[model samples]
Structure formats: structure tokens, C-alpha cells
Target: MTTLTIRRPDDWHVHFRDGAVLEAVLPHTSKDFGRAIVMPNLVPPVVTTADAEAYRRRILSALPDGHDFRPLMTLYLTETTDADDVEKGFRDGLISAVKLYPAGATTNSQSGVRDVARVYPVLERMAEIGLPLCVHGEVTDPDIDIFDREAVFIERVLAPVRQRFPALRIVMEHVTTKDGVDYVRSQAENTAATITVHHLIINRNAILAGGIRPHYYCLPVAKRESHRLALVEAATSGDARFFLGTDSAPHPTHLKEAACGCAGVFSSINAMACLAEVFEAAGAMDRLEGFTSLNGPAFYRMEPNTAEVTLVRRPEPVAYPATVPFDGGAITVFDPIFPIHWECVPAR
Candidate 1:
């Protein structure tokens, strides 16, 4: 129970912001993950094949030497997106999927699709070409409560999309509610969900228990304790429908602690160690590989990594950096609020 080894894992969701931030944070994810589906929500966004190609190149260049990491690029889905261009990207292997961020849903999503119907042509084309659509999965209606947005999105937006394009593949990213888990299960054949490390470990209390703890804040904001337990059960159940997507977003420490802070948690540095603690605590240690390594590739129609990564538990807690320096500022790392004893390293 103290030692565990599994195939090298892939982060199904991550954000490596451009320039200085990208350079500072890319190493943490690349260190432990064999591949990562890099998010396209950035300034000017990666909305075309050319953009994805350029972004992929930048990610590769930023990667530290000796790490064989692949950045699986995705196009930011906008209402004006070109269907032909999307098909070409998937056909040429430059892009793995298309990201659907409901306009105003999260950071840098102002250019996202506002009217779903306007993008039917693109969605139909993606379905025809077998390309998956990764969604933020929250409705941005001003009247809807933040906690209820994910559930409302399923009823008002996602369900209709699913009913219309039954063949299109979908990944509900960073699912935070039981409603999301149940919906993904209902559409089991062509649908799956990616659970983040922070959502599995913390609830809304992490952000609002006594006073606002801005560092724990994130989009699709963590739900209640009951929802966290649902996420735990689903992840540890060894179901192929649920897998790891850390959503390891980084914001400058000053920005995170400000009056109006950014929404993200940078956990790429200790994600596996935190996951080991979670799985072990749930008494589902044996199924950790499926959640972290095997199932994601199966869902994405890719091969699992042949290499192995080992996590060793020690008597004392492992030390993880509190913040990573970036351009004279720093980005805060997520604190799971619990001690982690496991340390992960690539198997030689």
C-alpha cells in the first residue's frame, strides 16, 4: 500500500498561458504527464488550425529538455468557426478536439459561441469527422445561480445537442456536480467526463467556509460536500467514463488574492501525489491507474503510455512549492488542505 506504479499518466485538461507564465508552469505538468490536452482559451485564443499549430510549437519549445511530452492542441470553438478548417486540423493531426466555451462562461471566453444554433454546421462537420467537442458545461445566464449553472446547461444546452448530434463525441470538462456525472453516465456510449483534482478534494467550503479563500476559487466552482463524494465515488469506481483532467490553471499570486480574483487552481505540480492520497483514502488504490492513465487514452482513441511512473509513500509528508515565480510575480499552487505523503517520479 506504500508503493504504487502505473503507466505514465496524461492530463486530459490543462492551461499553459502564453509567454512568461507558460514558460514557468509548463515544466510542472510536463514533469509527470506524458501528454496533456492544452486549453485554447487565451488572449486572441487558438481558434484555427494555424493557431493550434503555433501554440503547440510554443509549448514544445517551452518544455524542459529530457521530457518527452506531447501537447494535444484544441481549437477554441467560436460561432464564426470554419467547419472546413476544423476538419482539416483533425485530418492533419494538428488538433485533437474543439473546445466549446459558452460566451462569458469563464476566463477569456468572451469570443466563445453565444448562440449554439449558429455553430450547427461546425458541430455537424465535427460529428461527421469523428472529432470530439470539449465543453465548459455551464450556462452563463445572468439569472441562474452559479451553483446551478452546470445542471441548467445540461437541460437547456447539452441535452439538445446530444439529442441532435447523437454521433458527435463529447467530453464534459471538469464536471463539478452529480447532475453532470449522471448525465455523462446516461449517454455512456459517446460521452465521458473529466474530473479535476481540486474538485475531487475540496468543496465550496474550501472557498467560502469562514471568509472567501480566493485561491480555492475556480470556474464550475466546486459544489457541496455531497457532490464531492459523488465525484470521489465515480473516480474510484474504475469507470471508463470518468478520468483525470487537473484543469491546472495558473494566475499571478497578486491577481489571485485581489478583490476580484481569477478563477483557477494550479495543481499540476503535485496532482499525482494528491490523487494518490485521495484514491488511497477512498480504499480504491487499485483503480488509480484507470482514472489517471488508462481510461483517458481509451476515451480519446489513443494508446496508453508504455512507460511507467511510480509513487512511493513515506513516513513524512512530501514538500511541494507554495508558489512558482513568474516575471517577478508568482502563481499560487493549490493547497489540498491535507498532508500528502506520496511522491511521484518516472520509472526508469
Candidate 2:
């Protein structure tokens, strides 16, 4: 089998938590990706231009020596987010997008926007400035069934937002179902979707197949197997509407193994390796470059990465737990959520 060498990929969505966790995980991400859109859901969320700039600097400081990774920063939208600040951040190149999280949607998201309508001014400013809105795309209503949240969000929140701000570009992050795929496909011009490596390879069954697997649990959670196939198809189809976003969220092991486990998967260490397996399984290895590297930059109106990275087809098992020495413990690096026979051997 032949190896594939392509331009360095950009992770359209990722979470590099602050401090030691950030230091430990940043290398895995920087080694493979040239740039990544860093999530804003830090302890208090990056809610201001100054906050984003400071956070970006911290990320740079945390990077291991000699690594040239860029962390594209974002603003966390809140009920009181000022539109002028949003515009200024974008204009000054301090922020690339604004992230909307319906409060309680994921980790450290209690400060997320309580009501989308309340943030219309911020959305309008983003639309006017041509800055895309990256959304978690799940509702926090306790009455909504957990599995149906994304579809409901599409019907209730997404549809109205699309109608209200027709010019606004939206990226539905880490989409989990066929409904999401169809939604983005229908509005391909103004809307795009990001697919995570785990969601593309496994499904809801993996979560319960061999008992409750805490590592498999994530926000928007995994959907049924059929949905998994749809995500795989959409990702490997060479459609610019779908791109790579590891959403490689990491939590301390105790937090994840507790009575109420946290919702996220730490997949940074194995993200590209898992993605390569998925593309190869679908017989679409040739299209992996576009999904992993090209489409995200195209959607964001940024230049594709110029540096090259290579991956070869070799069967080897990459050990989990690359060491999360924070919280006085280590967290397991999430696998593909499936057994993989093929491995990624990075070229020298």
C-alpha cells in the first residue's frame, strides 16, 4: 500500500485546557496540525477580545519549544456580549469566530448564552463582519430527550437563527446525526458542519455495548450506528461543507470515572490516526486531505497550510494514556471507539 503525504491539516475545532493539561496535550496537536480553532470554554469562557488575546498568548507560552502551531482564538457569546467588541476583535485579528453554547451544553458552559435571541446584536455584528458563528448546537432544556437534542435544536433554534440572520455563516460543530448532515447539505452555501473522529467511527452502541464506557460519553453524545455511517459518508465525500474538528476535550480521570462522569473524549493523541482509519475503511483515502486539511480553511476564508505532513499505512497499536500528569493522575487517551487494525506511521 502507498503512503499519503499532504499539506499539514488544521483542526477546525479543538479544546486545549489551560495549565499543565494544556502543556501535556498541546504537543500532540501541534505535531500533526498546523493551526487549530481553539475552543473558548475555558473556566470562565473567553468572553472578550482582551480575554481571547490573553488566552492566545497563554496557549503560545504553553507550546513546547520549536513548535510553530497557531491557535486561532474565538469569543464566547453571552447574553450580554457587545456587538462592537465582537467586530473589533475580528477586525484586529484577535478573534476568528464567536462560539455559542446554550448554557449547560458542555464542560464549563454555565456562562454560555441563556437565550440566542438575546445575543442577536452579537450575531448581527459577526454576520456583518463576515465572522462565522461556531455553535455547540444542542439545547439545554431538561424536557428534551438527550438523543433528540440536535434535531430539536435544528428545528427550534437553528432554523430561526438561519432565518433571522440569513447572511451569517454557521458551523454546526461535531455533528452527530443524519438530520444534521441533511441540514448542512440543504444549506451548504451559508452553513457548514464539523465531524469528530469518534462520532464518525462509532455510535451510541459503543457507549453501551460492553457496559457504560465513560470515555465514549460526550456532549451531543454518540447517535445510533446508522447515523455513524452517514457521518462517515458526509466526511469522506469531498464536500467542503464537512471538515475535521477533533473536539478532543480532556478531563481528569477521577472526574470521568466518578458517579457523574464528565462529558467529553480526550482524542487529541489519536485524532488523525483514527480519522485515517475511517477514511481508509470507506475506501476514500484519497479524499482524506480535503476533509482533514483543505475544507476547513476554505470555509473560514483562510489560506490552506503550506507545510507538508505524511502518514503511512502500518498496523501498530498506539498506547492510550499519553500521560495527563495533571490532577495528580493520568487520563486515558480515547481510542477510535472501535478496534483498529491499521495504524498511522508518521513519515520522518
Candidate 3:
């Protein structure tokens, strides 16, 4: 098809960091996505409703003029996270979900809960209140292979939680392996998964192939090709349980190009364009709306956007910058490794 239009989409996962970083990247997302489940793993992390509220204001302040984006804030779940505060945030509409980072699963996760049992009370309360727990879904044990963490997390941690609180809604964020997809399918009733544009497009080879391309690196890091195919199947299947969450995390280019690089893919700038190319490759263009716009709000128990966004395939490839400026510096944009012909905008 030359053109496609769907409800303005929401990103169930995103990280618009604080300060200058947040300001530089907020527009990339706000330009197209109607709303996003803003991640709370900043330096201090948003551990309370007040923190989320303050952060939300900062996000609003940074948004470009005429942009109608809403940041759906989240609390970084911790052993000390107050169940009452969590429930209050959910009820008051200040927070969309609570994130469990597994104490070193990803960036700024040192304060994450180390022991799942320590937060059983909080988990039980969330289940009771129907608040969804968005998990990073990777075990950070020193002995486990990096590639095996997500699978191990499913077997060791997530499975028990599922059994204990069958009613709790859970979203396995940026799922990178087939194991994750299978587990989510198994829970069919109250479980779902968010796939990233980076994961759907690249594999470990993109990072370590000809050389160590640090920009391609990310947490739960990209897995093998078979796993990528599995994610593609889940996303393009039009399954309600599978939806879009770009996980469009941005780390400064200096940090990413360092000896010990950070983990994230800054795709907010080109997410819809990349997703259009991905869905087109799968020959599941018809299901793109279900993955990007429809399923996420359904899982979040919110209404689909009243507005629509249109993406048109241009005759020539759309030109996108290699880097987006930030202060005097810049962060490299994600290279989709494919020609991008689609340009997304509000559907008039």
C-alpha cells in the first residue's frame, strides 16, 4: 500500500530522561506517539507518586509547542515502594504502571528490588488493585549467561508471581527471546508483551558483527535471528497480547561510544518509519495498527486515540539525520539498516 492510517499510537515503553536529554528527545516521540508509558529509571528514579508528578511536569515543560503528547508516568518499583502510594497513583491517574528492574537488569537499576519476596506485599496489593507490573524480565544473577537472563527470569521469577497472583496484569517489557513470547502466550488471560523496533530489526550480530557497534547495544540485549523471527511472528500476528513499545531509550553518544558502553536504542526519532518498514517486510502491514495503536491501550484499559496518524510511502526514501543535536553534542539516531520510505504525520 502507498499509504496507511491508524489511531495515533501510544508507546507502552519509553525513556525520556531528565534535564537536557529529556528536552532533546521528547519531541521525537511527541511528534507521532499520542502518549507513552514514561520509564522511571532516572539517576534517582521515580519511586513515589510525588516523584512521578514532578517528573511529568518536567516532561510537559520540555514538550515542543503544539505537541499534544502525554507522558504516562511509572514508578520504579522497589522493596521500599509503598503499596498505598502505588495504588493511589494508579487510582489518581498519576502513574500508568510500576516497573521492576531486578536490581541491575538494566541502566540505573542498581536500586531495583534484589529479592522478589521482599516485595510480595506490594505485588499482592498491585494485583488486588489491578495495576499492571511492567517487568524488565531479565535475571541479573552473576552466574547466568547474558543471553539466558530473560528465559531464566521467566522460569525462576515470573512463573511464581503468575501462579501466586493470577489476576494481576503484567507486561513483559522489550521481550527479546522466544521464551518470553511463549510464556506470555501461556498466560493468555492477563499477560502481554511489548516488542521494540530495534529488537525486531537487529540481532546480536548488529552489535558484534564486523566490529563492536555500541549504538546497536541494548539491555536483555538483542538475541539470535530465530528469536527475532519469533518476535516478528508475535507482533505481526495481530494478537491483542502483543503490541508496540519502542523502548526508545537515549544515552549520550559519548557514553554509547565509550569503552564500557551503555544499553539503549534511541529510536523515538524514527520509530514509526522503522515499524512501517518492519511490518511491510513481514507482509503484515494490515496488522501494523493492531501492534502499534490498538493493543497497547486495550491492555492498559484506556480508550484508543480519537485522532489518527497517517504514514505515506514516498517515491524516494525519506532522509533522516544520522544524529540529533543535544546541547553542543549529539546522540546517534538508530539506523534501521533498511531503506525508509514512510513519513508519518497526523491524518487530516
Candidate 3 residue pairs in clash (backbone atoms < 3 Å): none
**Per-residue C-alpha lDDT of model 3 across residues 232-294, encoded as one tens digit per residue:** 999999889999999998988999999999999999988999999999989999999999999
Sequence-dependent TM-score of model 2: 0.96
Q: Which ranges in model 3 have alpha carbons more than 4 Å from their true place?
A: none
Q: Write the per-residue lDDT of candidate 2 for residues 18-48, one digit (tens) a residue.
A: 8888887888899889999999999878999
Local distance difference test, candidate 1: 0.95
In order, candidate lDDTs are 0.95, 0.87, 0.93
Q: Model 1 off-target regions past 4 Å?
A: none
Q: Report the poorest 10 consecutive residues by lDDT, candidate 2.
A: 338-347
Model 1, span 1-348: residue lDDT tens: 889999999999999999999999999999999999999998999999999999899999999999989999999999899999999999999889999999999999999989999999999999998999999999999999999999999999999999999999999999999999999988856899999999999999989989999999999899999999999999999889999999999999899899899999999999999999999999999999999999999989999999999999989999899999988699999899999999998886
RMSD of 3: 0.8
lDDT ranking of the models? 1, 3, 2
Show model 2 residue runs off by greater than 4 Å: 315-323, 337-348
